[model samples]
Target: MSKKLAVVTGATGGIGAEIAKQLAQNGWRCLLVGRNETALETLRKSLGEGHEIIVEDLQDERAMAAIAVRADALGGTALLVNNAGLNQMLPFENTPSSMILNQLCVNLVAPMRLTQALLAQLKRTHGTVVNIGSAFGAIGYPYQSIYCASKFGLRGFTEALSRELDGEVQVKYLAPRATDTKINDMKVRAMNEALGNKMDSPELVANEFMTLLNSSARRRAIGFPEKFFARLNGVFPELVDSAIIKQLKTIKSFLGTKESSL
Candidate 1:
């Protein structure tokens, strides 16, 4: 029997790495994509044989095309996990235009472009496209305006794409709440010191994501409180905004001073 091919972007990160590992364990020949050659090599070695690693920055359009070509050579792609993203906490006005562009490119554009590039192959296999979004996508957060915008765009894209590709492909948006990845260490510690809450663990988030992957659910939002708040915000916009504003006042106290411009 031929092995299934799965592609995961940002495969060096905590959640992405775990997803690649889990998928490989599930009998898929995983194609790990990331900018870090060292980390990718490390993960490739750990995953042992069938798995392949592609060291390419998703931000480069040509590189994404090359990824599609590589997957095609592997007997067509069966799954594409668009998990590459960037995030930073900064006041909206203070965020540089370049940073905003970079975030949009990595978080939104790359996924959309790569999906477009690989659509034919995925369709042939009746494959799935998993977009790793964030809870911030559902609701706006203070000091995360741009990040939220990118995620919101991603969610919107996923919803529309899921409907458009209803018959040909499975499209899913998995939104994970604040996870205890390296990205959140400092912020988590500060939040814990002030707001009395720490981020969730990456392993926990990864497990939730795997559950979503196994289920037929079109949208999966991790973290109960965030999910509830997202739903409430969707229904009661004004009330939710007011409540979030009040909550942000407290959360901001824990955010600490801006260390560097995002």
Candidate 2:
């Protein structure tokens, strides 16, 4: 019999690697996708057995098509973790046009297209699609405007897909709060520190993510207060506005730092 196959984007490191590790530990074969072949190979080897690797830039328009063909070669996929994402911290005015477009493409459009491309395989295998969104997506943080917009778009896409494919395939949206990864620049880290924001390590999140995947729940928000705030903001945007408005000074302090904004 064939092993249960899983495809994970952004699988070379950080949360994506951890998620893939946990899935493999639970007996799912992995197809790791990322931009670096060496990194993908490193992760594929670390995963032990029953795995493969695909080196492709998620920013490319052809990525969805390529990922679909790779999935076909695996027979089909049992799970699709759209874990690839771009995280940046910068003021709206400082963000370059090219950077803005790339952010949306990687964080929002890529997942949307990937899911569309893999819908047939997902339906046939009763597969699950896990979109890794952010608390920023729900609440729209001060410095990361474009990042927030992309996540918000992703959140909406996930919700619509869940409703559209409810019984045919399980679509889930998992929102994680500030995570400890290279994605966070030192300036961003300092702001989080100043604000006393909680940061979840990739391992801790991967563990919780696995639990969420096993349950019947269609969506979940990781981290308290962030989770609490996401729901609260949904019901009362004005209340959240009042709260976030107070953080402008702190957010501005980190804006001019020499950070990649990626």
Root-mean-square deviation of Cα positions for candidate 2 versus the true structure, in angstroms: 3.1
TM-score of each: 0.93, 0.95
lDDT of 1 by residue, 1-262 (tens): 3379999998997888988877777778889999998999899888879889898987788987899999999888899999988887766777899999999999999999999999999999999999999998999877888889999999999999999999899999999988766656576467655755446777787788789888999999988788998998888878878876766655666565544422
Global lDDT of each model? Answer: 0.86, 0.88
Candidate 2 residue lDDT tens string, 179-239? 9988898988898999889899999889988988999988888898898889999999899
Reference-based lDDT, residue 239, model 2 = 94
The list of candidate 1 runs beyond 4 A from truth reads 254-262
Every model: Cα RMSD to truth: 3.0, 3.1
lDDT of 1 at 195: 57
Among all windows of 10 consecutive residues in model 1, the one with the lowest summed lDDT is 253-262
Q: Number of the top candidate by lDDT?
A: 2
Per-residue lDDT value at 215 in model 2: 96
